[model samples]
Target: MVELPKRHKLEQSNRTREDEKLREFDEDIPDLRSLVIPWASMVIVAVIAAGIVLYNNHCDGEHSEDQLFFQSSDTMVEGSSYKESILERFLSAVTVEQHHVHKPVYEENHPSLFPLTTADRLGFSFVIIGLMVAAGGGIGGGGILVPIYILVMGFSPKHAIPLSNITVFGGAIANMILNVEKRHPLADRPLIDWDLILVMEPLTIAGALLGAFLNKLLPEVLLTIMLVILLSFTAYTSLKKAVKMYKAESRALREQGLKPDGTKESELTHINHQVEATDTNKAGDELLKDMDLQEGESPGTGDMESLAADKADELQKILDEERVTPMYNVSLLVGLFVFIISINMAKGGGAFPSPIGIKCGTYSFWMANGIMLGTIFLFCVYVRAYLVERFKAKERCGYKYVNGDIQWNSRATIVYPCICCLAGFFAGMFGVGGGIVKGPLMLAMEVHPAVASASSACMILFTSFTATTSFFVFGLLDPQYAPVCFGIGFIATYFGQIGLSILMKRSQRNSYIAFSIGGGVALSAVLMTIQSVLSLAEGEQHKSGGICGKDS
Candidate 1:
């Protein structure tokens, strides 16, 4: 190797350097397919497995929790009043002797709307209108439409839940379309956060299903207590929000250097420049502190830094204030879950409980619908009156009303009614009070809380009507029990209306509904667990006894 020429050796060294650089470059470049494929496959497999597990847990099996299948709990027997215990024992006996022997016929046959008799059709139509009217009345200081429907119609909570849900479904879709097409307010801006809504929906639906099941397993007294507690909480929350709004408004006025009442506009208008100068001075000081450059730092550098910092801070503040983070979309799901758990504890009846056993008749469905529709009509009328009176009141104050014209063609008019119809359809299929969703949608459309609540009532009633019609069409309606359910429901509904009216006058109405629903869901979940465990134990006892006591 020592015999090589000097020039050749130099060339060899240069070649070696080039080779090393090439090797390093090659090392930096990864194999695209080999690097990504395995990880992608793993992710896909994991997702598939998770989905299967969730389906098994929530959707599949003979008694899917989503389908509202549940057994009454053992704890339901505890703390029973003497009268309640006697009634429970009798019901249990009847359930064992009658219901257990003959699986409910209606449950097996999904109903269509074609076979509804003229009387049933008329009755249901009236009820739908009535529900709407009642809802309006409640929100406008009249009645709580939902409870009224349940109590008056004698329609089991399960049936009412779905019926109400369909209305919300329809109404939401309609509103979305109108917002996009007619109003154009939500257009050209990513105003509606789909990500939040998507995340929340499944949770809410799951909660609703669970609530429905729990309703089957629990007792009524516990449900009532939970409702009361929820009502109180809602009232408190509403008041808290109102206070917060007032405080925020006051703070804003003070920041603008205006009087609290904003009566002296001229005195405050000249302070804008002074306020700007003060803000600048403060921002400059902050900049100097951030740079580790003290008060003695070069005046030019300090000034520049302060200006930059001031701009950054201003931008940050603007961003924070302008961001539209929606609480309703996500919170709705949580509330729904709460409701599901609580209502189940009420342990009412089912959507298609044994037709031969206790058919909640067509009239029951009709009355619920009627209440809602009637409420809507009432709301429109009330709103018109309120607007007129408000304008007159303003005139009396020496200020002509600037805007008395209600925008009828605005997006809300179309969106709200549409949401009602869509929500109504699905709700009927599921047998629920789709009002939960409808209430929020109504609020979003800038409807007054009262009107929104009333609209929800109206929508729910129609949904129930559609559902009842379907049930009857499918030969699920039992005529004999119809009168009895309607009579009982009528009283209950009326009472609910009166109670809700009293609450609304105090501005504590909506909260009551929210709290009642949330509490009801939670209570139902507990009751269901208790009932299931007891039923299992009972089965075990019977197995050990070998001789059964003729099944209750």
Candidate 2:
């Protein structure tokens, strides 16, 4: 046979060399410095907790958890002195100074802010730990925070939900501020997926506003059941998706005659990008046809050898890196309306009045424009998002990423905002941050668990901040707890974020861990549902006679 062309041989050799390099490489693992931060953080928090509890216990005389210098009053009824009629409540809702600075006084006849004692010490520790776990994994800590306040501190749901959200705002704020810092090693691509956050934020805030309003509309039992179902589905779907992806990936790699690693399938996908409907190498095919009858003893071997000698697949392996997958616009529009209703409801039944709802009837005077501004901003996000993306007007974050096993889908676009809207609605309606399960849902959609969790952490901040603002607007989040709970919670949450950054950065495969966290959250939701049921049952028992009581 005549010599093969030098150009073809050079190209063939290059393909072989490149493929060998790709097959041999591995990503580097994170080093010791990453471990130091989380360990030190744990020590500092533990020491402070131990010292504070010891000091408070040693100085103050033993007191019951219920021991308070001031007690909450019921049925104030907006007495004859002030005309807080339903109409007046509506007008004054935005005008009320619910966030006034809280004064702490234990002197004669003076009201106290949050009382700090042994019980508070216990509460502070538990709250910090729970939030740390949740925030580290990109949850808002609402899953555990609600139960902490209700069960440990004896707060009613009305009180606990708002307080928990307001408390988590501390952590979210801390993490947001930290996100701005460029000194961190991973600053180039920070954990906060701002691209996803931008799309999800407004919808989530709007939902929180509406849900806060919806808080009083439902019976307590219904809310409990809904949350339990939502959480359970989140956990189940995440585990199921992870397993399915792993198996599919394994099978594909097996067929490809490659040992499975996380990177192999993505490499094959990169190769797939070069495949086209029409054959690309007509000249090469024609040249081979002329040589087809030549050397191989077997007639079949001649054509097979010529086909194997053609190196077109190797040459076309470069992927089309950025592929567009559009999100459904109709779902987003529907979500927008839902968010507005939730927000209005959060304004002390501004949209729909309920007996248990706060009525903000005061005419707009100071800060009344907040709702209007927020509404315009949220609606604008929905309307402008498509235009911005379509025109390539400015460089913004992409809504979806196509990573190894993870990719974008229109369904994700529809499902994601719907979840946010629901979470927001309930957050506003019940004063509880509902995005705690958002991480799991994102994971189920095949996002890298770490990225999903990070996105969750950032998004929860918006949900919590918005919900807390409503609580402040409606006089639900007492300013007294601001310093102790919100302030302290903020510091604790910052540390949690730090710990999370260190932990997530070190892991190469975090899907299993992420799924486990989701499972734990689902279990927590189950407990919350049981608690809601017992609370209703106990109330019924009170209406009837107690077990031991004789008719008086």
Candidate 3:
């Protein structure tokens, strides 16, 4: 009885300490009322999600709703060169609903993994859906696509990496178009970093082309290993940066002396997607001003002053809620490694860029070099112009809070290029626009979140389009993948965008939310990496056996 009392006391003490820690954690996190969704929105979302699940579960035939336009031609799977074990692995997860096709669409031992047979059309649709989701997860969907193709689709690493870039071209295009509409309507005066884009565009183009060319030299197994490593790094960068955002937000809030309202962790915010079709351009703004103007007051007088004040308040609010979480030096250095490797690749990769053009497959060494050198020269000029402008700005006015100012809180001056280089290479190599990766990098460089997202969206479009075109011209891309990848990806992105908007509206979408996503992606990347290594080993063995048989 005496020992039992002592045990109870010890348990009570431990519980008290745990409760205290929980209280501290609660206090540390910010209250984001905007993240809370209403009950009605939640119900609607649940209904929609259930409907989708039920529909997918029941019906599993047809390429899409309109079968007349969608059909497999050159892209159809015909041979049995693809690894069978890997094919079975992916197919095992999916439901085979090709009972309608009585005749076999292709040979049983066909090497092709996708569109298994006329009966396997059901599986192909699932793949399209998966790719769509993957694209939305990564900045341009290319990062996720490569993994899916290799680990799930059972494609050769060389083919998967390049095709990954090509397939998500539609998503990038969609993302770009959306950003354009958002940023470029006169009065909207989108908070774009044009100078930054101009300075970086050349690097992006040169770096991607170089990466694409270099991609050809590596052995298949080596390439898969490299791709896996790249995925891990990309995953880490996304997640780590996200993790640091919470404290940064708190710090920024403290600096601004603004704290959000108190809300329980258990209560999630519900956001209703009530979009009003308003003319949200400069003209509309001016028109609104005109309507608000007093009989004797000019449009420029009081209206401008009020608008300025409102703008300032809005900016301050955003600033107060966000913090400048600079990336670690080690993290930034990894990017520098990528830049150095890019330079080395240009210098050491196979054929020299001779004065006389030399054609290697679809690429001309001299032409590519010439274009790169020209872009480098332009980049240099832009840098000089930027420096002069900065000097002039400093001389004219001392440091003051300006809208869209580059507010890097750490050693970000040299790090920006490394970021651009890594993102560019990855974009070119995989056809993933790297916008998702770049957006976080921009954020790390102290660019505003809104600006970062907008800038990333624009760049993603360019990167994907360039990568896709480059592959197509180089004869590495098949036009067949485009119809499926682009059409489904395009539609998926629209719905994905809407969902993201709704989620953001219902919750405080800050660093924490971003961190969760990055962590999830990184976890997936790790698994894919393991699977890729095994697949590569198995493939090499299979090749060796075939060679031995031929010799015998």
List RMSD in Å for every model shown.
22.9, 17.9, 22.3
**Model 1, which residues run further than 4 Å from truth?**
1-143, 150-174, 177-190, 250-350, 353-552
Model 2 scores worst on lDDT over the 10 consecutive residues at 542-551
- The worst-scoring run of ten residues by lDDT in candidate 3 lies at 543-552
Q: Kindly list the per-residue Cα lDDT of model 1 for residues 281-314, writing each as its tens digit.
A: 4433433333343344333454445544554565
lDDT of 2 by residue, 419-476 (tens): 5555455445444455554565455444556556656666666556656666665566
Candidate with top lDDT is: 2
Candidate 3 error regions (>4 Å): 1-138, 154-163, 183-192, 210-230, 246-357, 361-367, 387-391, 394-404, 407-415, 425-433, 474-479, 516-524, 527-531, 540-552
423-523 per-residue lDDT for model 3 (tens digits) = 56654543345564465455545454445555665556555665555445444543454456666667766665555545543443455335534643464
Please give the lDDT score at residue 330 for candidate 1. Answer: 37
Local accuracy by lDDT, each model = 0.35, 0.48, 0.44
Q: TM-scores for all candidates? A: 0.31, 0.51, 0.51
**Cα error, candidate 1, residue 60 (Å):** 31
